[model samples]
Target: MRSEAASPILAFHEELASDIRTGLAGPGQKMIPSRYLYDDLGSALFDAISFLPEYGLTRADERILRTHARDIVGRLPGPITVAELGSGSGRKTRWILEAIARRGSTTYYPIDISRAALTRCALELGQLPSVRVEPIERDYLRGLSEVAARRGKSDRLLLLFLGSTIGNFEPAQARDFIREVGERLKPGDGFLLGTDLLKPVPTLLAAYDDPLGVTAAFNLNLLMHLNRDLDADFDPGSFAHEARWSAAERRIEMHLVVRRAHTVTIRGLDMRIRFEERETIWTESSYKVEREDTARLAKHGGFDCLSQWVDREWPFAESLLLRR
Candidate 1:
């Protein structure tokens, strides 16, 4: 029984180690999967980032949900099941759930790779009347698949991909991910997508690289996560957090720029990696989109844009799409 319980943890560590090895040893720019940046500490730091004055994405998302929660919920049929991808703490989700619960009982499946986030989500959302919170501690797509399987044949699902998290993917990858999601849903099901709009380069840079340094702390925490989880001797202080806006790519990139060359040993993986001065490990990329692009993305994902609400204050979009 103990072994059975420990298997998942063992598998997670193995997968993490494998990804780190592949990412660090790969040709061209070394990179780490952005998902790894959301362990407990990383998630908490990100929650702090959302509150930073310079970071307005989270606020923009909440604003849309708060303003149009009922309108968005009204668009969907009753007896609906709600599922959210990467639902950190599910604080913004209250608006939608409250709106839904006012009509009928709701079963919310909040999926995330971070257990800490899921725990908080379950606790925070479980208190709502007529709402049942079922937290899924898994990556987005797989968790959504499980939700689909558990759903009744005629059930209408409202799948939410909020916080502009889709921006983490490259354009093509984003399309592929949405298509995969569409494959798991039935016709008439709905999708609520949040996307950050193209703004001034300075604003974009400020959101990712805030002057308060919360964003930097969030970026640097990824190294600390690796050090603790992988038994690695990474000098977090040796690498500085840097954010760059790529005009051509229409994205903001975060990287850890190594200050000096050094070698680090990963005792867990039984491997040693050498770093060169000025070389960087690309950590994350956040893509910004135009309003029209939301419709295009929905169409490519086998969804039709039903409606879109834009937040004027921060220039963010919340698009509602229905499966074709």
Candidate 2:
């Protein structure tokens, strides 16, 4: 369910095909890669989702950054490099950058998969004095690897993976991913990780399956992306958005449930994907973390949890992990 090809668009198409072929045509009922939900329109829809009152993860993380900006920045060495993975729109990032810039001039690396988003962030950050922005247009790991490879041995780097993006990965994968990040770090470097905490199921359900339907638009937009790029016939209207909390997994799952049996044709892959009535395509998972588990994972990944700042009201946490 992957592709090694280099062309961005081709690789994207191939990956989409592989996932569909594996998920839909194979053992699984159906599933789509959540990452593919970031096409231009999808990105914009997410920006809208962030603004929704029900979707408080963004605001909660922003509050934590604003309240503890200095403390968060102070934990890091001064005149350091701030690297942010999946730097969307650069709104929440400005809080971190401003805090860092107040101490001294700092380099900002905003990494993202969208070239347009990267360009926007770079242009916006460039306007800020005392901050030099170099945006990396690639997925988080590859971009982080490039930044890690280019760093000097004596560099002080504080990597930021905010907005509970870590929640997207399952537990074991989350640990392994954090370990990969730790492997890239030298002692004295730090990682600022934002994680959503387990909360009432009602709150969780509202955030994903919003009353405003913006989240639904964000989820269904994935179909539009495929329809446009892969030449697939997906009547988005035929699917309903669903958000369910899996208590055992401590995650909220987003799915698109087919209302009727139909076949989706992808011209690029020369494949037709059939779906059964009521079949669901699992789209994304947002995993909430326990405070103790976050600390344990940091230690397991070769880092010490230096500090944690939480907005107890929303129950969001921003933990600072230092490489050891």
Candidate 3:
């Protein structure tokens, strides 16, 4: 059963079908928007991926939030309203919300593309005594804008972009995204940004392509997602998940490589695509950054870095930035 929410899912059937047709029929590398990877099953698979031993990103994020949530909240002025972009599961959000709730009542807006994710987030965080859980089922920017519109004159907005989801964007896109986020904020509003730091190639590779193949399953599930949602005939077995590190881009790329040549049809779109053996459909990219990069990113977004907490064990950074 689909759960109800204030905001409807933005990626409706027509928009999704259009995106799929454009991405698959494009001249360059065949691809699908990484956002499509988070259908109900994909979101659950990702939750599982976070628990894999090799994937320490989520643990690192939780550690930083737990240790510094108070300090992060303290840096902001009174009457803070929390809004988190891509608030998956939102299990790690307890630290920040608890910190805010300690002071007084607050409203928490968890914006996500997946209805299932928003539903789960509401269930997980709705129990906070002083925090009201409001789930918005929309893409990041649009959802943030809606939150911005609802902000009270005296409420300080603390935008949480945790889980290193920003790494999924290209460098330029990331900067632009941050800047756009700042546009929706008044001076003194806060932005908590999470970024995975640059680490050894082997460690990074292992994190994306875990030994137990949970990550592989997570990546492969995208095809299953498309098949189920779009009435597409994608052979999940015809392709293998591949994770590669791009030295120049400083990013880990997830791809679905075709194992054998075949043609797949999207009955809904009435389109057919021919896949050549070894051909790859680029799915997602996660760009690792240096410690200093966080501050630079904050500055680029018209925000000042108030504080940055690093997790030594995993080399992850949670930077607190103030809109300027």
Best by TM-score: 1
Against the reference, the lDDT scores of all candidates come to: 0.91, 0.86, 0.90
Off by over 4 Å in 1: 2-11
Error of 2 at 72 (Å): 0.7
Candidate 2 collision pairs: none
**Candidate 1 colliding pairs:** none
Models, CA RMSD each: 1.4, 2.9, 2.2
In candidate 2, position 305 carries an lDDT of 96
Give the local distance difference test score of model 3. Answer: 0.90
Show where candidate 2 strays beyond 4 Å: 1-13
Candidate 3 residues 1-324, lDDT tens each? Answer: 354443254346667888889989778799887888888888898999999889999999999999888988999868999999989889999999999999999999998888888898998899889999888878888899889888778999999999899999989999899999999999999999999999999999999998898888888999988888778899899999999999999999999999999999988788899999999999999999998998988898899999889999999999999999
TM-scores for candidates 1 onward, in order:
0.97, 0.94, 0.95
**lDDT tens readout by residue for model 1, 89-127:** 899999999999999898999988788989999988999
Cα lDDT tens digits, model 2, 113-213, are: 77778788888888888999888767778789988976656669999998988999988998999999998888899999999999999989999988889
Return whichever of 1 and 3 wins on lDDT. Answer: 1
